[model samples]
Target: MSDDLEILLTNDDGIRSTGIRALYDALSEHANVTVVAPASDRSACGRSISHAVDVHEHDLGYAVEGTPADCVVAGLAELGPFPDLVVAGCNEGANLGEYVLGRSGTISAAVEAAFFDVPAIATSLYVPADDETPYYEFDVTTDDFAEAARVTTFLAEHALDAGVFDHAAYLNVNVPLPDGDPAPIEITRPSKRYEMDAERNGDAVHLTDRVWESMDPESLPDPEGTDRRAVVEGRISVSPLTAPHATNHHEILEELAAAYRSQ
Candidate 1:
C-alpha cells in the first residue's frame, strides 16, 4: 500500500503550520505525499481561487502564494504527481457544521478536489476551551496532532479499497484534541444547528457565532450522529459529503420561464 499510493496534501493553514507538518510526517510513512499549500494562513477563505500566483520551493513541497483552492489546482495540474487521493489539513480548528462548510478553507480545498473527480479528506482538530485557557488563545504544537495523523493515515491507506469514495466525493473529518486516549471514530452528518447573531452599534455590526459558546458536552443542543456532537463528546467525526450544491427540478421555475417568453 505504501509503495503504490500518492497523496497530494494541502491545508488552509500556511505551509509551515505544525498541523500540516504533522500530517506530512505521518502520511508520508504510508504513501508518497506532496505538500502544496498557501504560504500564509488563508483560513475561512471559501473556494476563492487565484488565477495567477507565485510558487516557491520548500523543504516539504511547493508553497503557493494563494488560497487553499489554488493550492489544489496547482498541485493536481502542475507540481505534484496525479494523486490517488487529496488530503487537506489537520487544521488548527474544527470545520464542523454545514453552515461553516462554504466558508472553511479546509472544506473548500476538499470540495475543490472533488470537482476534479478525486477522492478527498479534510481533517480538523476540535479544540475545546479549557476552564482556564480559551480555545481561541490555545497554542497547539505539532506533537498534539499525533492521534489525528494516525487516524488520517489509516483512512488514507484503506478508505479507497473500502468503497468510501463511491458513496461520497469527499469526507469532512473533525477530531477532538488528544486527551486521555485516542478518540473513537464516529460516522456522522454535518449538524444543521445555526446560531449566527448580528448586532448593530453605531456604524458597526458585530457578528458572532454563538455555536462556539454553547459547546458544553453535557448540555449541547446537537443530537447524536452529528459532527458537532461527536467531536464535543471526544469522538472523531467523519462526515461523508458531496461537493457542489445539490439541486432539484422545479415546476414553478419552469412555468416562470415559459411565461417570461410571452412577455
Candidate 2:
C-alpha cells in the first residue's frame, strides 16, 4: 500500500444508499476514494457480470447500469488508475454464513477484487428480522452506519500493514447497530447452518427462511465463535475469506481417474 492509496468503493445497494455515502465520507478522509457502484439495487446477484455495462459519472462517482460484480470489473479494467484496495458495501442486510456469501452482491464484489489480486472488504449491517418488524424495515440512515464506517476506515488504514490479508483474500464484515458508542469488533468464521423452508400459498410457492429466528439474541444457537453469534451479541463480526476454488484433494476422484486410464 502506498502513502496515498487509491481505494475503489462500491456496494450492492444503489449509489444513493446511505451505507455507501457514509463509507465514501469516512474513507475519503484516509485515501483517494473512487466510487463505481450500481445505479440501482442489485442485491443477491452474486458474481454475475456484464461485459458491456453502461457507466455514467455522478457527484459521488461513476454509477454502472449493472451488478456489483460488473462495477468491480469495469472499475478495474476500464475506469483507469487501478485501486490499491477495493471496499464493497455497508450492505443493507448482513451477509453471514458461507451460504449467503455466494449469493450476496456485496460479498461477490469483494470476491471479484480478490481474483484481481487486490485486497477487499465487504461490510454489511445486521438488522434483526422479526415478524413485527420486517427485514427491510430498518432505517438505514447515514448515522446508523457510523460504527461500520469507523471499522472499515480502521481496517483500510492498517489491515495491509498488519498483514491481515496474507492468510485471507478478503474480509466479510457484519455490524450490529451501535447501541451507544461504537461496538466491539470480533474475528469470526461464518456460521454453519442450512435452513431453507418452502410453503405453498394458493397457486404460488413461497420460500421461507427461518434462519433469522435463530439469530435472535435470546434464541440464537450459533456458537460463540461464529459470525452470526457475534452480531447477535452486539459485536462487529469480521470473517476472513478467500475466493471460491477447490483446495481439498479427493482420493475417490483420483481412483476414478486411475480406473479410466486402465480402461
Candidate 3:
C-alpha cells in the first residue's frame, strides 16, 4: 500500500447509474479514482465476461459494451494503471442471500478482481418493503446514495492500512435506504432463504421469482447475524468473503481414487 493510491471504480448498473456517480464523487475526494464500467445495465450477470468488447469514453469515465467483469479486467489489465483497490457498485437493488451472491454482477466484479490479487468491495442499497411498489422500483438518486458512498470511501481509505483484506479477497456491503437517522453497521453472513416459483400459462410456462415479496418485515426467520436480518433491521450489512471455492474432503472421492489405483 503506497501513500498515493489508485482505485478502479466499476458497477453492474453502467457508468451513468446514480449509484456509481455518487460513489465516484465521494471516492474522488479521497483517492485517485478511475471509472470503467458497463455501458448498459448488467445486473445479475455474475462473472460472465465478453469475448470482445467495444469501449467508448463517456464524460464520467470509460463505458464498455460488456459485463461488470469485463470492465474490471479491462480497467486493470489494459485501460488504466494497476489499482490498489477495485470498488463495485452501490447497486440499485440489494444483493443479500447466499443464492443471490453468485448471481449478482456487482459481487462477481469483486470476485474477478480478487483473482487478480486486488482487494475489492461490492455495495448495494436495499429498498424498503412495500406491496404497492412495482418490480425494480426504487428511487436511487445521487443524494440517496451519499451515506453508502461515504462508508465505502472511508473503508477504501483505510481498509488496506488496516489489513482488512489479508484474510478475505472482497467484502459485500448492503446499505439500507436512509430514513432520517443513520443506521447501525453490522458484520454479517449471507442468509440462506430462497424464494422462487413458476406458473404455467397455456403451453409455455411463466417463471416468477419474488424473494423480496416473501420477506416479512415483522418476523424474518433469519437470525441477527445474517445479512438479510441486518438489512431488514435497518442496518448496514458487511460480509467479508473469499474468492476461491471451499474444498470437500468426503470419503466418496477418496474411495474413487483408491478404485482408480486398483485398476
Candidate 4:
C-alpha cells in the first residue's frame, strides 16, 4: 500500500450518523479519510446497489442517494483518490452470526470493497440486547463510539504494516458498548446459531427473534471463540472474512448434470 493511505469511510446509518462522524474524526488523524454514505438511514439494505445514483457534496463528505454498497461503488469508481482501504461503519447494532452477515448493510459495504480488491473493515456497536433496552431502542451518541473509533483507528494505522490482510479480503468488527474503556480484542468467527423466529397473525406473519432479549454472556449458547460469545462477554470481536466467487468443482452437481444430459 501507499505511505499516505487513502481510506474510504462509509456506513449503513447514513452520512450524518454519529458513528460515521466519530470514524471520520479518528481515521482522518492517520489517513486521507473520505466519507461517502447514504443521505438517510439505509440500515439492513445489504449489498443492493442501484444502476444509477445521485450524489450530493455535503459539508462532511459526499452523500449518495443509495445503499451502503452503492456508496462504496460510487466512491471507488467515481470519487477521487482511490482508497487503499475501505472501512464501513461503527454501525448502531451488532451484526453477528453467519446468517446475519448477508443481511447487514454495514458488512455488505466491506464485501463490495473486497470485490474491488481493496482490504476493508466493517465495524458495529453491540448494544445490550434486552427487552427494555432492545437493540432498536438504544440511542448511540457520538460519545458512545469513542472505543470503536479508537480501535478502528488503531487497525487502520497498523493492519497493513502487520500484513493482516494478506489472506483476508475484509474484517468484520463488533464492539460491545463500552463498559469502562472497552474490553480486549478477540479474534473470532461468526456464530453458527440461527435465531430467527416467526409467528402467524390473522393476516400477516410476524418474524422476530427473542434472542436479543436474553443476551447476557451466561445465557448465550455461543461457544468460547465465536463473535457473539466475545461481544456478550464484553470483548471486541474481529472476524476475518472473504467475498467468495462460485466454483464449478462440485462432483455431485456434475453427476446430476451428466444424468440430465443423458436423459
Candidate 5:
C-alpha cells in the first residue's frame, strides 16, 4: 500500500445520492478518494455491467451511464490513478442475507473489484421499516452518516494494514441507523432466509417480496453470529467474503466419466 492511500468510491444509488456524497466527504480527510458511480439508480442490479458506457465528468466525480460493477471495472482498469482499494456505498438500504448477496448492486461492485484482486468494502444502512421507503430521503442533508462513515473510513484506512484481506476479498457491512451512540461492530455471515411470494390478481400476477415486512427484530430466526441477527440487534454487521464461486463435489461428472471409460 502507498503512503498516499488511493480509494475508488462508488455506489448503486447513483452519483447524486447523499450516501455517496457523505462517504466521499468523510473519506477525503484520510485518503485520496475518487468517485465514479452510476448516472442513475441501479439498485439490485447485481454484478451486471453495461456492454458500452458513456462516462462524463461531474461536479463530484465521473458519472458513468452503467451499473455499479461497470463503474468500478472501468475506474480501475481504464481510468487514471488505479486505486489501491475499492469502497462501495453507504447505501440507503441494507444488503443482508445470503439471498441478497447475489441481487445487491452495492455488494456486487465490491465483488467485481475483488475479481481484480483489489480489496473492497460494501457499506449500507439498514432502514427500520416494513417496505422500501427510505428512512432518510436522498435530499435530506445532515451529519447522520458520521457513525457509519467513521467506521467505514477507519476500515478503509487500516483494514489493509491489519492484513484483514489476507483471508478474504471483500467485506459486506450493514450499519444500523444511529441511535444517539455508535453500536458495537460484529463479524457475521449472511443469513440464508428469504421471503418471496406471488399473488394472482385477475390477468396480472403481483410479485410480492416481503423481506422487509417480515424482518421483525423480535421474531428473527437468525443465530447470534449472523448478519441478519447483528443488524436486528442494532449492531454494525461486517461479513468478510470471497468473490470466486466455491467448487463442490460433482457426482454427475464422476458417473459420466466412469460410464465413458466402461463403454
Candidate 6:
C-alpha cells in the first residue's frame, strides 16, 4: 500500500461513467491515479486503435476521443506519467467468457498494457439481464461499483510486489452486485460456452447472444472454476492470463520448407 505507486487508469465505458469514477476514487487513495480514458462510451470496441485522436484536459485526467487502446497508448507514450500498472474498467458489463476476450474494450486495454510489458487488471461487474430489463438499462450508480473498486484497489496495492506478474501478463476480473458477505475471490478461467443466434429477416440478419438467457443460477451452462459461474454464484472471478498467443513448431511445416528448398 505504498502511496508512491503510479497507476494509469483507463476504461472502455468512457471517462464519465460511474464505474471509472468509482475506480478512480478508490485507486486515488492508494496511489497516484491518472485517468486516461475515452471521452465517450466505447463499450465492446475491442482493441481498435485510431491514427489520430483529439485530447482534452479533464478534472480527473485526460480524455481521448478514441478507443480504450488509444487511451492507453496516449497515456503511456505522451500524456500521463509512466506508470507501474494499468487498471482498466469496473466495466459496465462483464467480460466473462473466452469469446468476449477479443471483443471487449475493457479487456483489450489491459492486453495492450500487457504488450508493453506492464501488468494490468481489467475489472468488470456481472450485471444480470432478464427478458424485460437488461443490466444495461438498470440505473447503475457509483455505489454499485464499490466492491469492484475495493477488489481492484487491493490488487493494485499488493499484486506487483507479490510477484503476481511473473505468472500472468494481466488479470481479467469480474464482480457481481454485493450480497451478504463480501464476495469470495476465485481464480478462474474464461468459460468456453458460446451461443450465437442469427435470424434472417427480409433484408437483415438479427444476431443475438443466446448465452445471456442462461445467466441465472438454474440455467448457467458453465461449471465451477469458470468466470460466468463464479459471478452467477456471487463470487468474484479473476482470470490470470497471458497477452500474446502461443505458437509451436511442427515437423509438417519443416518438411514443406525442405521440399520447397529442393524445388
Tens digit of per-residue lDDT, candidate 1, span 68-177: 99999999998879899999998998988989999999999999999999999999988887557666578898778988898899899889999999999999999988
Query: TM-score for each prediction?
Result: 0.95, 0.95, 0.94, 0.95, 0.92, 0.96
**TM-score of candidate 1 relative to the true fold:** 0.95
Tell me the deviation in Å of residue 197 in model 6.
1.8
Q: Candidate 2's residue-wise lDDT over 22-123, tens digit each?
A: 999999987999999999999988999886889999998899999999999999988946998999988988988878988899999999999999999999
RMSD, one per candidate, in order: 1.6, 1.5, 1.8, 1.8, 2.3, 1.4
**Model 3 root mean square deviation, Cα atoms:** 1.8
Q: List the residue pairs that clash in candidate 1.
A: none
What are the lDDT scores of the predictions, listed in order? 0.92, 0.90, 0.88, 0.88, 0.87, 0.93
Candidate 2 Cα misplacement greater than 4 A, ranges: 1-3
Worst 10 residues of 6 by lDDT: 176-185
Instruction: Tell me how candidate 4 scores on lDDT.
Output: 0.88
The digit string of per-residue lDDT tens for model 6 on 159-185 reads: 999999999999999999976578889
Q: Given candidate 4, what's the lDDT at residue 249?
A: 92
- Candidate 4, poorest ten consecutive residues by summed lDDT: 129-138
Model 6 stretches with alpha carbons more than 4 Å out: 252-263
Better of 2 and 3 by TM-score: 2
Residue 148 of model 6: what lDDT?
96
- Of the candidates numbered 2 and 5, which has the greater lDDT value? 2
Better of 3 and 6 by lDDT: 6
- Model 6 has an lDDT value of 0.93
For residues 99-209, could you state the per-residue lDDT of candidate 4 as single tens digits?
888889999999999999999999999887555566767777888898899889888888888989997889999998877765799999999888688899999899986
Displacement of the residue 92 alpha carbon in candidate 5, Å: 0.4
lDDT of 2 at 200: 88
- Point out the worst 10-residue segment of candidate 2 by lDDT: 208-217
